[model samples]
Target: MTVCAIEMTTTAPFTIAADGSYAARLAGDGEALYAERWTLAGPEPYAVPLPLAQPEEADTELLPLADGRVLIHRRVAERHAFALLYPTGAAAGPRTGELPLGAVCAEEGGDVRVRLLPPSPDGRDAFALAVTGAGTTVWRVAGGAFGPEQVARIPGRCSGGVWLDRVGRLLALDHELDGTTKAVAVDLGRGGEVSPLLQITEASDDRLLLADPDSGLLLIRSDAPGEPRLGWGVLGSSLPVRFPECLRLGDAHPFAVQPGQALMPETSGVALRLPDGRIGLWRPADRQVFRFGAPAGWLGGTGLWSAQGRLHLPYATPEVPCGIVGMSLPPAPPPPVRLDPAPPTPTRPIPLQQAPL
Candidate 1:
């Protein structure tokens, strides 16, 4: 389905959990910003306002945890801080206020920038990337034993964070160094040991956008085909990445992939944002893009797919402050059977510029 966009610059994008149970966003009122959490696992999705005593800055980032606490990231001068906000009383009772957690600072400014990664698949721990001129530091911003802790320091300026596994131990990042960019996997469990993940070609800039832990399906964008194109690949497969001609729409990006479809990666639904401010839905097996109009006030490029194939989009209008509209996937047609002899083996993807460190 084609996703539409609205000019809602004041509000921040919703940070949803991997399981689609909860989400957090920064809602603005005139010049002030406040944190809000949405509970989606219940009968009906609803939001809880989480305004602190003072208004939050526009750059503050928020991520919701499965336990119902919202992790907040803010910059105080040069130090980027981390904290958790939760209601003091029980969820059913009146919300006393937000309880701030300890902060993790990464002197951010000038040539350095720090931001939270996507919600961890485990939904218990949270992480952030501190990108500096020399390297990127991955910090456990929340859910650590003692507040925030430095987990790994990866050499090179990295961007784009995707958890390759369910436990969040293996992280895939697009590392740009010496004028080339390629996706590399960081083994957080092993002192952030880095390894090649996506190396389409020596010159190609390969980036991993989204991955499905259940199916090992990876949504990738790379310029290996002379031009940047969206493609799909298996996590550990040796097959050369297949750049589908149907996914060549300029500037389009995939944001969400269907989960719980273990071993059926090709059937999982993929959501992408078209260049002209529309959302595109496609499946690898079908190899065709489905167009649909985006809801008014829909958060562009941010959504969650249910295990049952429902795509839930979070949107907010002036009348309805927080809302989610789900789009049901159209039944896919059967694939054509092959009558000719089996094809030759596909090409193996090229290795990274350097060996794993």
Candidate 2:
């Protein structure tokens, strides 16, 4: 069945909060720009258009913070700038920052470790790597400051890293010299020491994409043959649970892994599109599969997640223009009620006399 569309003039990447609220980047024609916050249960989401300082020339990314705030990262000039949006009424200006090793990267697990680098300056770009557990530079920006940290060089370039918990432990995907990839868990608080977990292949350029790290499970993508496949592995386990089939890479870009499922409110897991064009949710503990119908005209270029116990799917439906769709599962049936016969009542009632009479 077709669902209602959440209208948007222009939509960018969004992060779903634990409460099912969302903060997304909304871009309209002209320099009209801002981050909008929406909740599925509310009548309408709150849209806060950014103040028109100078027109932003490029797109931006909205990263949700743990404190109910958001970090807006906009790429300007040759470097990236960031802004902190407070839950109250304060907004920090765009701050200049540098990426480690001069590569395009993303923060994993809140602000745990960074992963992936854009094309290298010398033209040999590394797709995967992470800050080693023994590596002291695991944190360059501390106390809520934005900056790059230097560290000892490791054997392979890191394609992705994920923080498994709030304690700073991380799982990273390393692209080894022999073209294969391996998953390693590094204790960022300790020195950058590597603990071997799973080895996918032995080629130097094998790409390992870290998706979401929740509790102790890590969602990863193996792109050795250029076709992406989803895999789930634990921190110390050698065998990885590979999804039966490959997943659609969607415009050749990495799909963000949302930590929890909105539809299945009782469980926690990762959701993504499989190669067969089906959006699948895999619960890491039991590997239970939850499949949803892909809306018509969705070229796999959509974002899928459960927010506020409702499914938030943003896709291009053929019947309608591009927009975000929110869906909630039907509530469970009420217990069967037992009917009882009504008791008979007197046909008429006697009237009372006044004491004065």
Candidate 3:
């Protein structure tokens, strides 16, 4: 029997870059769906519509890059087409530009599924995962010297794409094999070298939820404690993973980690969804979880954390078709020093390894 993957379905109106610089989304004008890009790193955020002569399909996925280009993935029958969307001159002038990258056609069985991965940490490249019964293929859809290149293929079904390092080389994916799922690190630079990243237990299902490259912090979910619970760990730290009681809240899921805290991982803010649909904020230094009301027309469970502890949530309403609500968090106190280090548990993650392509 087949099992469902632990990946979160992309339903947000906008998909933001890992650097919080730009966003891409499909906007609807009552009848047709069109792609729109949002600029967030400026003094004031603004949206640019990249509508073509033809409307974009409802199922098309968009991922924004650091260079202001939006990568679009559209499925035409069994063939998956990729392209780059950029704004042209005036609307009265030439139409918005779309550079067709290439396409990936699925096998005949209709069992293959393809989707764009999250924005890469480097912000210059975009990737997609095509899952088939044989294996999962990673495709470099955008920001490639040659358009749409097949970079790596990993055995077994893999889900969840979390970049472990800042340069976008090490990727952590939850690999499902032999009815067991564990989070493994895929060295994209080494042609998808697989290594064990999260081995909480032999039988428990472990999935990586979120990662912060700046701080080397990782948010994880695992059933090692008899049931699935959210936990925290450092990328290469010798410390065993810790599942805080405050993180076990019902229906809560971590979405973003505050960046630019390389020396203080515990001080980094974590943005999560509360059980009541509101936004919840927490930090490892502070064991308490604070709840904030989500903005009206908020894209559910989607947001980004700034280095200074501000949460930027994207929302669209009649009044504000494209808007981002910024929430400033109170400063967190420094972490308390523990003279006696915690004992290492058996659930520590294994070090990453690389293999030839």
Candidate 4:
């Protein structure tokens, strides 16, 4: 099928707010930060320039905070830090904080939770959260106010981390162990106990790990084969159902399905990744599909989410530095038109009356 006449623009990191508004980032030509907001209703996007208090370099890890602010992870050689950027004029200066981990990954919630390798004198592996707090002494101290927790120290590198629940009780860790890679879900609230959710014995790489906050359905990707394959299972279940067939159905990259959204009970959402790597908004109930194109060189690995009734894609393309490209789903297509073949042309009438004359 040919792509319909719809143009997709490149966008930066974006998130759907509680009120259904979308907040996205756009860096200007000179690398100045700007924030753009768009509504679900069709309208031209509006942007606001954000000023940097400190002359720090660009940080790619942009996460939206629950309190309408954005968290940026800044790396300076071996030192890692974080800064909070409020919307437009909400705050005077950027809130900066130092972290123990050489690198930090953040997830916003009631509090901005950062997963960073803890400061270990012996070079042991650790992950911890640096919670926002009071003045210098109150925040500067490590492991006291909001410090690092050594969850599971393995022999190799820690690949991925995600919170399994709202309260952050269960932590999912993707790490390499015994020359193999696996995803292990650990109960952090009870203790640092770990249990295997999915394992790969052969030479494989875990590309992505996504957990539904509501349903607890865990989706994982493995590069055991040349291309990525999706596998999903319930939180505590060991039996993972591999959707190898889903991968064969075109360029279907995995998109995250929000809780309580319209989705297949077995699967989530009506969206399907086409063979060409474009996302099709699908409604299996209605048997309808709408296609949306991504910016030129952008791959679908960027996280896609449907929250507050809008489809938000935090994609990075070669054209646009960073922003969220969103498009509303159009109404279902009408029934196919049927055309009957033309009736056979009538032959020339015979002139028998001329013979009688």
| Clashing pairs in model 1, backbone N/Cα/C closer than 3 A | 1-292, 2-279, 2-291, 2-292, 3-279, 4-294
What residue runs in model 1 are displaced by over 4 Å at the alpha carbon? 1-10, 89-96, 106-111, 335-357
Please write out the lDDT profile of model 1 over residues 179-225, one tens digit for every residue.
99999888888898888888777888999898887777788888877
Scored by TM-score, the top model is 3
lDDT of 4 by residue, 16-125 (tens): 33233434344444465444333332354344444455443444444443344544455554434544555444354543332342233233322333333211111112
Pick the winner on lDDT between candidates 2 and 3.
Answer: 3
The residue-level lDDT of candidate 4 at 187 comes to: 62
Model 1 per-residue lDDT at 256: 90
Predicted candidate 3 versus true structure: per-residue lDDT over 17-118, tens digit per residue: 878899888886654888888999998788898888878877789999999999999888778998888987765775588899998887676567899988
lDDT agreement with native, every candidate: 0.78, 0.41, 0.79, 0.43
Candidate 1, residue 91: the lDDT equals 56
Off by over 4 Å in 2: 1-10, 17-22, 30-32, 37-45, 76-78, 86-156, 176-178, 201-215, 223-228, 237-240, 243-270, 274-278, 282-310, 314-357
Per-candidate TM-score against the hidden true structure: 0.88, 0.54, 0.89, 0.57
lDDT of 1 at 277: 63
- Poorest lDDT segment (10 consecutive residues) of candidate 4: 348-357
lDDT over C-alpha atoms for residue 209 of model 2: 51
